[model samples]
Target: MGTKFGSVIHRADRGTFRAKYTYHGEVITKTFKDRLSAEAWLNGERSRVEADKAGITKWTSPTDRKRQEAAVKRRRTLFCDYVMDEFAPTWLNYATDGSELASGSKRKHREYLQHLTHSFFWKYPLTSITTEDINRWLADLDNFGGATPRKKTFQLLKAVYSKAVAEGAVAKSPVTMKAPAVPKSRQAQIPPATAEELQTIYANMPSTTRISVWLGAILDLRIGEVVSLQVQDWNPKTQTLRVCHSADVNGQLKSTKTATSNTTQPVPPQLGKLIDKACEDKRPTDFIVTCADGTHITPNRLRDHFNEAKTKARRPDLHFHTLRATSITAAVATGASLKDTMQWGRHADAATSIERYQRASGTERMREIANGIEDTLMGHEPTREELEAEIQKTKERLADLERQLDALK
Candidate 1:
């Protein structure tokens, strides 16, 4: 039986006091160690019991001594209760926006958290989680595959721990305790097409799909942007295609992948004409590119059909992202510098696109310059007979100019 009186003596833990009473139906006896706190609580209980005042606030536990023992046992045997239960929601959302993860990155985070709970992190109090534990997780993650997943797993760990730090659930994240050394996976950017190859590709597809993907790769629009292109999004007067909206799985309005994604992409004259054709005789709400069923084309379906075009063109390596890669290549070839490529790609990150995607070594650059010079000089070189023909043509042009000048006089 629990003690009816609420008197409590302060324990060695200082703040905790031991008291026994019926609190809310449970006979919870734990430490309620503070003197003033114990007295206030006891008076409240006495008022409720003696005066029959049902409105008095109830104490946390019916038996305070037993609760204190249970708490001590938990602390001695358990390592898991570091982060408070209430702090999880904010931390999950933190992984999405604050971390700058890839699309659907939350799914990966859930996996990491689920794994950590089953691993040693489950028992280690969030405050007590050490650098060794994080490194151990990294070691186990590295055994799975190459650099990409290892980096992904490391990032997930950082996010979850960082959240605990922010919520005051831990003194500091073990993530910050040690630097993790991870090898970078250099994603081999697909090479862009020469003008001739593009002409070949553009020739194969119907005007609508060909130009749409081509413009997308050039603009570096997110896959969602490709599907949401509308007739009104094109402004021929400005020779620009606006990216005003993006689609979800259900083809509804959603915020673009990032703020940078909502941008205007300059449409070349050739692509502008294709947009016009797709929009020809269509309503304002009509789409630019559609499926066989006349619904807007999704990114997955676009990539599938784009592959067929690549196959027919005898270039099997090309993919949808390749189009954007090729566009940056073309911009570079046209003397659009690396900084220009970043702008076109809408990379909010300040690094030049050449660093991220394009790699033009000094040797390759000199070769390109040599080839350009050779092509220019070779195209206009004059042979002996051709020189004589040019002399005659020049005399005729001079004579024509003289005639025009005299006629004007």
Candidate 2:
């Protein structure tokens, strides 16, 4: 006779016991010589099933378990293969912050990945790469170029290891060191162009592209935004310009840099007229700035023209982006509040308007402040001309007060 205990079955004719179980629609069966062995195997299998159900393990069947183990081993054994073949492609699709990577950012990240190929541990397993290995690789970046490139490379590597950790490919990131800092000398702020210098640069630009200079200097638009403008973005009736998109280096139109950058700004009447003139015979879809052949003007093309214009104006140090700083500084000089300046520049915060765009006080404004300080602190007597001017100002105030009193009566 045959006896059965749970999923363990005894066959009398074969004098053997079989442990059999089904999990996730897959059958698992094994033969044992004795009943005790069959019972033991059955208990262990059931425990594995429970663990899998509880999310403690992924044990489904022996074949699936082997496949998962092999995949983990391959991820550990072939690090560069995992990175270049698997991780980089996936990581490039989405940024580390979980947003879709922009085209320009994707291109830059691809370049950064190339630097990792030159590392000594490029072929090492993910688990085998230690913090010391990452340090050595960073130290070797100097041979490739300057600190800026090295810093970017280090950041990319750190992001890679972080992805590996999240995927369970590595227990922890090996890139434990802080990022390398580029020297301050290389990060000095370029001074904004003066109003006179801006005029000279604009005058030197080609007639077809001169509007770009005004767009940048007056609207505080980025080069990308200037090149991305379309005929429809301008409202002649409302005298407003909409900034909703920017062009990448490849001249592909994309969303603006930030949510706040997509806004409707009041355009100066003069600039609005220029835009109306530019759109005279063009359709709404036509680009506002175009080359001679009527093709859309790319940022690179605008930049090349701007470079020539600046060179001719004797301001080779002036970049097209300096126009934005000039516009923000001009707004501040008009006694505009910080909030107004930030809105004019389309910046996210007032601190950026103050620290980055606004320049130091002009020579005349500083002189006025210095004179006022002397008068207040030194107790200097007013000159006869100043006293006479004060008396005339008082008479004007008395006249205004009397007029207001008569109106109230």
Q: Which candidate achieves the best TM-score against the true structure? A: 2
Which residue runs does candidate 1 get wrong by more than 4 Å?
1-88, 94-105, 142-146, 163-172, 176-187, 248-253, 336-339, 348-354, 357-363, 366-409
Q: Clash number for every model?
A: 17, 0
Q: Candidate 1, 403: how far from true, in Å?
A: 32
Across 1-409, the per-residue lDDT of candidate 2 in tens digits comes to: 2234237778889999878877677778889899788888777877887888899987777777787897678566667887887678877667555777667667777777777787888898878888887777777655447787788778778877777788777777878888987764422356667866778888888776888998998898999999889999999989998999999888899977755678998898878888888888999999988886788888999999899989877888878888887777677677867668777777755656666433434555688899999988997888999999999999999998999999999
What digit string (tens of lDDT, one per residue) describes model 1 on residues 1-409?
1235655656765667765555446553445547666666766665655543354544343345457665555445333444335434545445344644334445555555555455656676445668887777667653535555556556656766676567544556677544345553333445665555666776776555676566665566666677788888887789898887777665665556655667887877766777777788777777777776667777777666777777777878776666666666666666776677777767656644655444533346788779789878886556899899989999999998999999999
Off by over 4 Å in 2: 1-75, 96-100, 184-188, 245-263, 291-296, 311-313, 331-409
Compute the lDDT for candidate 2: 0.79
Q: Deviation in angstroms for 43 in model 2?
A: 9.3
